[model samples]
Target: MKAIVIGAGMGGASAGIALRNFGWQTEIYEAVAQVKPVGAAISIWPNGVKCLNFLGLQRQIKAIGGDMASMAYQDYQSGQILTRFPLRPLVDRVGEFPYPTARAELQSMLLDEFGRGRVFLNKRLIQLEDNGSQVTAGFADGSTATGDLLIGADGTHSMVRRHVLGHDVKRRYAGYVNWNGLVEIDEAIAPANQWTTFVGQGKRVSLMPVAGRRFYYFFDVPLPTGLKQSRDTSRKDLKRYFTGWCAPVQRLIEQLDPMATNRVEIHDIEPFSTLVRGRVALLGDAAHSTTPDIGQGGCAAMEDAVVLSLSLRAHSLGVEDALRRYQESRVERVTSLVLKARKRCDVTHGKDPLATRQWYHSLEHETGEHILNGMAETILGGPL
Candidate 1:
């Protein structure tokens, strides 16, 4: 069998690798003239790690990933640690420690594994056609590819998703602006192996370890959508928004290179009832885009890749049947996650002031185990 994978991102590349493992020929089409990582870093939780292991990229992921051993939540202004917890218990329970990896390194590893020749650049998908037995993709560059199945991994603003639903699905703004980038690891800011976060006033500043003695950091402010943001004024903007934040946050803003930081207005789509139509199926953010509140966005994408491959392997019925099986298996799980993340986003960002204050109070009184158990619930629910 043959498959056409759209978008050469985390989901698309993993789908290509997984399908190939099952003896299917696959080609990945990317929209950009040159491939680049969209963000600074990503958290691959235990479930995501298990999917990578299944794809035979465990060694590569570990090589390019961070050693995250603990987590901490602190008051944004005072820098007082509200709670601190060792992640060892969660790691032991899930059988894998979550790795915070540089986006560039992780993308490079997946592309290398998928093989450069199998991935075509500058092929923006303009249209798709499915005629029961075979599916075809039309590119903006006036090129076309036909295969037995099509997997749309094109991200939140996905064209492929539009074709499947026969309508444009509006993306919901998560009511925040985010600035993220890489900075040299400094213990004065946080521990070398801890994921530290500071929260207050509907805002957040976080730093997590990544490879090569560096920290992947991000700042979140609950701002109105469509607010003007300029790269030239990024540092100034962050400084203004985080004026009363802790010393570590100030240091982060001062130390970061504005030119290198990525500013994103966060958005997510409501979960769809179906992710498949005939031989075409959606994967990753293309299937279910969610806010990063719970940190499972990429992990869910990896899960999709594995489940799609498994459905194909198990169902000898046909391409459409296999796609339907994949959809049925994923819709509930991904919907729950998307809704959960949305709720978490509201709580953390002060959309629900009562919930946000309650969460802070809970954190202060929390033992390490409660936090770890919550994470474990998400990690253990994976199809792996």
Candidate 2:
């Protein structure tokens, strides 16, 4: 069987690897001149790590990934710790470690595993035609490629998804903007193994460790969609937004080189009722784009790759049947996550300030065991 995958993000690369593992010839088309990960960092929960294990890349992932020892949620203004939780027990409960990794490094690893020669860069998808038994992909470069199956792993602005779903799906803004960058680790900002976040009044500052003694830091502010910030003004604007946040947050912002920062307005798609159409199917953000509030966006994409491969194998590559089963198996889980993440985003951004306060107050009394168990349940519930 031959499979053509669009977009060379985690989903596309992982889909290629998973399909090839099942003895299918696979090719990936990426619109970029060179495949580079968009974001700064991704927190790979146990569920996502499970996908890597299936692809036999766990060891490589661990090498490039930073393990979190703990997390501290603090009051944004007073800098008081609302809750401190250990992460080790959760790791033991799930039987796999969660990793905070640099997105580019993880992408490079996946591309290597999938075989770089099989990925065609700069091939922006124009259209896809399913001719009963085969699917043909038309590229903007005036090239055409055909395969037994086509997987659209393109992200939020997915062209393949537009073609397969036969409609223009717009990205729904999540009522916020984010500024992120990488900087040398500063234990003064947060412990090396701690994922520290300061939150209040619809804004947050987080500093999380990645590999190589570096930290990926971000500022999230509830703002109107389409708000733009120039580099000269971004630093000053961020400082103004996060005024009186905390000493560490202020210091971190001061250290940022505006040129190196990435600014984005977060958006998610409404969950698709269907993920497959004949010989073509959508994967990752293409199928179900969700807000990154819970850090499950990329993780969901990784799971999609594995689940699609398993479904294909289960149906013995009976194309349409496999695709149908894949959709049936994934829709509920991914949809639930999309809704859950949206809720998290709302709550985190002060949709109900009173409720957020109550939760923070409640966290003071919650035991580490309780917190760990709740998290473990979510991570362990993922596909085996």
Candidate 3:
């Protein structure tokens, strides 16, 4: 059987590889005219790394200088540790290793596995049709293709979702904007292979090692009740907003040489009740966007690809049945996760210092077993 996977983002590429692994013909349609990755570091927890390993590309990812270590959560501004979780420890416990790598590196790794012919660029989804025997996709350039299945691995603002599922889900602003900075390699701020977050009143900032030595940073701050990402904003405005956000944050803003960093805003999609709809389905941020608070956006997308392929191939390549299985298997798990991730953002961005402090203290007392169990349960489909 054949499949058309839309978007060509992390989810799409991962799904395409899985489908091909299971003896299914797969084609990826991407809207971008030329595929070049944006953003810096994206985390791949054990749940996702297992998929890469299954696809036989884990070592390739490792070769890209992925960071393998631990993550520390702090009081967003004061840099007080609330919790520190060892990623390698979780890997040992669950038999799944988590690694952090540059987005470009991952895309390259997956693309290498998928090969050139299976993925296409400049192919935007205009519509989707499923008239019993097969599912079909129409692109913006007026090209159309029919396949046994259509996977909406498209990110938020998914066209396949609207055309096939008849559901128009919108991105919900997270009451804040973010600034992304990929800093030069340095000993200060972030050491090699460690992730850190500093949380404080109405703001939070994270420093993660990308490609080992380089730093991938994102700072979150409250957005005016109904602000949208705009070009009208100025550097002075960002500097003013992030004023007094503690040491490194203000300093990071000062060193923001890249133009896009200051304008970055956090947006999430409303969690859906189902990702699979007929022969069409959704994955990645398209299906379950979340505040980047926990850095699971891409990881969950990768999981969807593995699980979807596993289920689809389980039924002798029954595309429709597989999609239904995918939905039944994933919705509850992904939805709960999206909500929990959002709550983390809430606590990190809470305006009340006292309340936020209490939350932080409470989180510190939270046990590693509880965390491991929770993390395991989120993707493993079992109680830890």
Candidate 4:
């Protein structure tokens, strides 16, 4: 069988790899001429790690990923630890390790594994047409490909999704803007094996180690919609916004290269009842975009790849049946997760000061075991 996958991001590449592993010929297309990963760090929890393991990438990811032993929440101004949640117990319970990895590194690995020949760049999808027996994808460069199946793994602003759903969908903002960058890790600032966050006043500064003794740090601030910033002014804005933060955070901000920092307004899509129509199916952010508060966006995409492959294998001779099964299997799980992540984002941003204060105090009283169980709930519930 032949499959055409739109969007060569992690989800699309993984879909191509998974389909190929199941003995299907898969071709992946990317709109961008050259892929440049924008996100700084990705927390690949055990669930996501398991998906990579299914793709035979666990060992390679571990080699390039950083180990996070524990997580701590601190006061942004005084740098006093509000609570410390150890993660080693979760590893023992789940029988899988969670690692933080650079987005570029992971993307490069997926590309290498998926075979570069199978991936086509500069192929922006313009339309998708599904006849009774087959589907065809139209590209902006006047190229077309017909296949038995089409996978829309394109991201939040997915063209494939727009085509499949037969309408344009607007992304809903998650009520905050985030600034992300990778900076040199210093032992004096924080320990390497810890995911540390400084929180206060409806804002947060977080840092986690990646490979090569570098930390992927991000700042989240509640801001108005449609706000824009240039590179030079964005750096200055970061400094001004975080003036009262801890010394380590201030130092980290100062060390960041103005041109290297990336500022983005976080957004997610509303839940859809289904992810498929005929031979076309949506996966990852294209299917159900979620806020990054829980770090499950990419992880969910990876899970979609595995489950969709399983469905195809089950209905090898029935492409439409496979798509129906894919939608039936994934819609409920991903929709609930999308809503959960949205709630988490709301709590983190704390649009209401009083509620936010209460939320922080509640975190102070949370036991390590409670936190571990919460993490376990998210990771252990994923598809095997």
The candidate maximizing TM-score is 1
Candidate 3 residue runs with Cα over 4 Å from true position: 73-87, 225-238, 260-262, 351-354, 363-384
Cα-based TM-score, every candidate: 0.99, 0.97, 0.88, 0.97
List all candidate RMSDs to the true structure: 0.8, 1.4, 3.0, 1.2
lDDT of each: 0.93, 0.87, 0.74, 0.88
Question: Which pairs clash inside model 3?
Answer: 75-199, 76-198, 76-199, 76-200, 77-199, 77-200
Q: Give lDDT tens digits, candidate 4, residues 158-206.
A: 8878767788888898889998888888766678889998998889989
- Comparison by TM-score, 2 against 4, better one: 4
Sort by lDDT, top down from the best: 1, 4, 2, 3
lDDT of 1 by residue, 1-384 (tens): 999999999999999999999999999999998999989999999999999999999899999889998899999989999999889989899899799999999999999999999999999998899988889999998999999999999999888888889899999999999899999998888999999999999889999999999999999999998877878889999999999889988988989989999999999998888799888999999999999889999999999999999999999888898889999999999999999899889988999888899999998998888878878998888998
| Model 2 steric clash pairs | none
Clashing pairs in 4: none
Q: How many Å off is the CA of 302 in candidate 3?
A: 1.2
Judged by whole-model lDDT over C-alpha atoms, candidate 4 comes out at: 0.88
The alpha-carbon lDDT assigned to residue 103 of candidate 2 equals 90
Better of 1 and 2 by lDDT: 1
Question: On residues 47-94, what C-alpha lDDT tens digit does candidate 3 reach at each position?
Answer: 777778887786786676457577776654565668876776667777
RMSD of 2: 1.4
